[model samples]
Target: MTSTFLGMPTTAPRGVGHLRGDQSFPAAARRALADSQLRRNLGHATATIRAKSAAVIAEAPDWQQLRDAGAAIKADVMARLPELLEQLEAAVTAAGGTVHWAADAVEANRIVTELVAATGSDRVIKVKSMATQEIGLNEALEAAGITPVETDLAELIVQLGDDRPSHILVPAIHRNRAEIREIFLREMPGVDPALTDDPVALAAAARRYLRQTFLHTPVAVSGANFAVAETGTLVVVESEGNGRMCLTLPETLITVMGVEKVVPTWRDLEVFLQLLPRASTGERMNPYTSMWTGVSPGDGPQQVHLVLLDNGRSAVLADEVGRQALHCIRCSACLNVCPVYERTGGHAYGSVYPGPIGAVLSPQLTGVEENASLPYASSLCGACYDACPVKINIPELLVHLRAAHVTAQRRPTTESIAMAAAAYTMDHPALYAAAQRAARLTRLAGRRGRGLPPPLSGWTIGRDLPQPPPQTFREWWAER
Candidate 1:
């Protein structure tokens, strides 16, 4: 990551490299894989969303066309981002929208926290938003003595329980009904201790608890799904009405959005409106769709502040192999389908972002050094690529970032030396032939393969190695 963007530390101390080789995952995966509760929760949640998403796609005959249009439009915008952004600024300003550009996470956090404080309210209601999470907005607000009350059902569950969101679409996805019941019993003041694990009971508990926070909080914070620059409008698509309450009820509204969320025209929204819901929550249309522009004449939040955050976006935009990352609409479809994420969930990634998008996007935004392990976290199965509506090519990017990391490193470790030796052997026929012959000689002629003994135990840690083939490809080639 750049040292400072618009004058602030662009990356964390551990950095993106931490994610690349962060052996931290295996420990978490081992524990979570055995957690039958986590497995059941993920299986049920992803399956339901998958079926609902399929139904929506089936209903739209032009679904593929819309996806194609969305992809093409995003590519076009990325190509001419500077010019389009200038035009966007002009259009939004002309339409009475106030746009504040933030160069890094700290600046963005400062801007939003100050805006909330200006409302002169100590508490602010919040919609479930990734951008806010990306910048750690809630923590920043709290540090400034402004309490952010999460109003979305899942967000409320996470906040009340003092937990981090493990899934993008369902922030409380890791918690089953029983866990939620326990959290409510412990955290919610008026919650009845007799509450059961029924969905109805859980929702009622959350509603009653949030209603009080909603009716009183004078400020709200949110993240946008998309912004239409042509009309200077911001759109939020959500399944719950809590997002609407947080958006409309507050006197002053502060929205923290990534710079890449902007689309050039109003008509382009039609494509995303279809793509986001089905891909994200697996719905044809979210229950609450809210839109707002600059200051609405006494209708919504009287004073609106939109912070266009460019934290690490400009750097990602500069990279040729990694730029497609910003095309993500925060759908989390990639996460839902990711096998690695399925086991470890979001926390293992160690940032606001998790799963496939987190693997690549986090490193690019946070810098490759600190999160380097993130790129290696993938099996490069290409499942994320198949699931992406915008075609992010996540697996391919993972490899590219991995190569960059190794090449930039000063020391060559055992794995690096082995890779180099293999590359050299493959390139030189004589050396490969001699090595093959030696391996064949070492192999037992007519017995089950024995495990490699200690000192060489590294090769046998997981399984016994199969005997080498009797004849090398060179020997076969000679016979032919």
Candidate 2:
């Protein structure tokens, strides 16, 4: 974890879009915690997901082994990413697919916008894509006068409400069925006024709304779950069949994938196919697992393009310890199990990615300075590590990012000064004893029920300061 990225830019480039939040994590979390409805919605949804995940996970005799294999494959991919990417590009080109490389969000958006423009299609159907969200593709397309219709059920909810996604897998997890019913009533065109909050009714309503768009949309945009270098294939796994429609019905398919999504072979891809579904949706397998290798003649999309997005990932990979954050398959098991995330919700983290993985990954992607508060968002309970299908050591990554943040500080803060003072006093026996005696005076403040003053008050605000004992261990030992 101590290893550094030599001759690499540790900081992400300015203006990485949705990666940076408007406010700090603490500030945002404070507001989110006060929202009773948000807490209730998140708590219920996460609890249900956790129960299902655990139930299915227990059915596997070799679940831990699967996790290990997934982790090892990711490690191998990271190590050989450059070579595999080149091989993938060559294979894809051979299969009649074009490849474009994007270094950051701005370039990525421009690439996609221009590609969409070239097709003479003013509207495109979309699968649920984190990469597209990270780059703000919908907004970009809108700006270019192209309408991007989100086909995923959850994504459709988010788009209709004009709300940012709060969860990775379930984008609208914060919305209860009642809230979703309202969104549809308000936003959906030609919707029935009597739609109830039932899941089946809601899904049917959404399906009806998207059916015409799916059949007519000439272009589609997507994100890959895994991309195979050996066969030039891209995979997308989803519970709903919306992704299947987007992949098949469109004349042109443009997939925006993070560089980390590339696997060395279809064999390596096999490990994650097993791991992702069970960990993510708590299902034995995804209902719709769609894959495409370039273009097929008179079958599916006639034109295929894959945009390999770097967007600070090169800097992330250069860091030895922080790079494992790339191993995430977006299962979101960590979010469901995270106590902090359960209460504060995904909006608090200020990224498309929320919860434990987001806490570590967002800051690293945008640089420690941009999202510094995120590293401290975790309680280090290690639940996220246990829940991760890829076995990403998220707790360990949090600590590493924290140390990186502290070391990058240009000036000493009050906490740093206080810690330094405490260290100096502890190094000397006489001074330590004197400090202990002095600390006893805090019992007076304790009796008054008033917390510490100024900068120290920050600590006391969230926690109780224990009153000093009447005598020290040394003093008691001497008396005995």
Candidate 3:
């Protein structure tokens, strides 16, 4: 497949407290354990990427500078988005392409559906796009009586399997060869009853299934990684030729993109194109990168429509501290490198995006006051920051969210009591030393008795609390 994701057309609330904030992320994580193949597949796939990415990144001397540049560029764009988007709309209109602005997922889907309906076609081929998935565009089109055929291989797998994407980049990361083989056997027609688990064979099976969709479907839907404002151009990079095929073959093309995707100039595309492929897929250059500015006179998609969707992005832009989360290029490098995300996988986070990015991005876009647990889902290992091509400070955002969570609720009983005692102990060193000395003497007492008193139960309950040295470190330092 050309794309890493075959995301389920997400079907939850478009509001702040959708499926995510209303329920804790753990219930979903627990349900995911029922699939043993998913566990095995995720473990094998992520481990390989983690090792390979680390090796390649370690060898690069200018990687940190590249990350800094990417971050700075994104920050500049976010700060200037209102102006850039205006410039983009003007350029697109002048170039004879119509632009549509959508306030949220509902509006975006409606705009796309209406545009397709105008074409008088009930079926369209699609390039795998997370924006469309986030807005549930396929289902909206389906409800409107339009059948959207997925052209990307992984997306085809997910569509046929009726599964939720488990990874941001590799949506079907949780499923292995045998499972894919099973999916193809059940959904795909004219499959040799003797399909092997080999990677090449699996890819060939998908290629054969999607060949007709590419040739026949007239209208196409896509999402962009970056949209150059200066020229009103849209760009998509991928490993396979499927995206290229979808872009050129269709009579009418509709591209839905986030407002944050705009850059000031075409020169900026070069920088991201350099950083994204390597950070995302460990590749020096992608096999196919398709770029189009509105439409040409006689070539490829005589009618082009661009949907600019802002589903909570404007609210996210309002927060200074959390706004950096938008700088992510959707490179799965962070998820691959994050120890916690590696163990839990993407589905555990219960959002279109999952992992460190999801932990902060979902909450900020959806509002963190309600999604209190998602921020705490991380171990704060800082691996995501280290791996981020755009240098988002994920750990710092986590700490900020943690503080916000604490302030939202009236402090828990045990936490309040424990912290108060800690405050009292730290305020008076002499008294603290005396208390410690008394507690240390308990080991000898415990030799004769069971354990310490109720106040000490919290510390001593889990394992043996070590006896203090003859004197405290402070006293020893003073003597020295």
Per-prediction count of colliding residue pairs? 22, 0, 1
Once fitted onto the true fold, the runs of candidate 2 whose alpha carbons sit more than 4 angstroms away are 1-11, 444-450, 467-470
Report the lDDT tens digits of candidate 3 across residue range 346-413.
77787777889889888776667656668877879898888889989999998887777777777575
Error of 3 at 400 (Å): 1.3
Show the lowest summed lDDT stretch of 10 residues, model 3: 8-17
Candidate 3 TM-score, true structure as reference: 0.86
The 0-to-1 C-alpha lDDT of every candidate, in the order given, reads: 0.79, 0.91, 0.80
In candidate 1, residue 171 scores what lDDT? 85
Query: Per-residue lDDT tens digits of candidate 1, residues 1-480?
Result: 545444343443232112233445544566677788888887777777777777877888987777788888888878877776777677667766667888767788888877777778998888988888877777788889988888888888999999988877888888888998999999989888889999998998888888878888888888998887777788898876888898888888888888888899889988898888878877788788998877677787877778888778887888887889989998989988887887677777776788999889888886787676778778788988887878788998999899888877899855687778989997998898898887786476323555555544444543466778889888999999
What shift in Å separates residue 430 of candidate 1 from its native position after superposition? 4.7
| Candidate 2 structure quality by residue, lDDT tens digits, 111-161 | 999999999999999999999999888988999999999999999999999
lDDT of 2: 0.91
Worst 10 residues of 2 by lDDT: 4-13
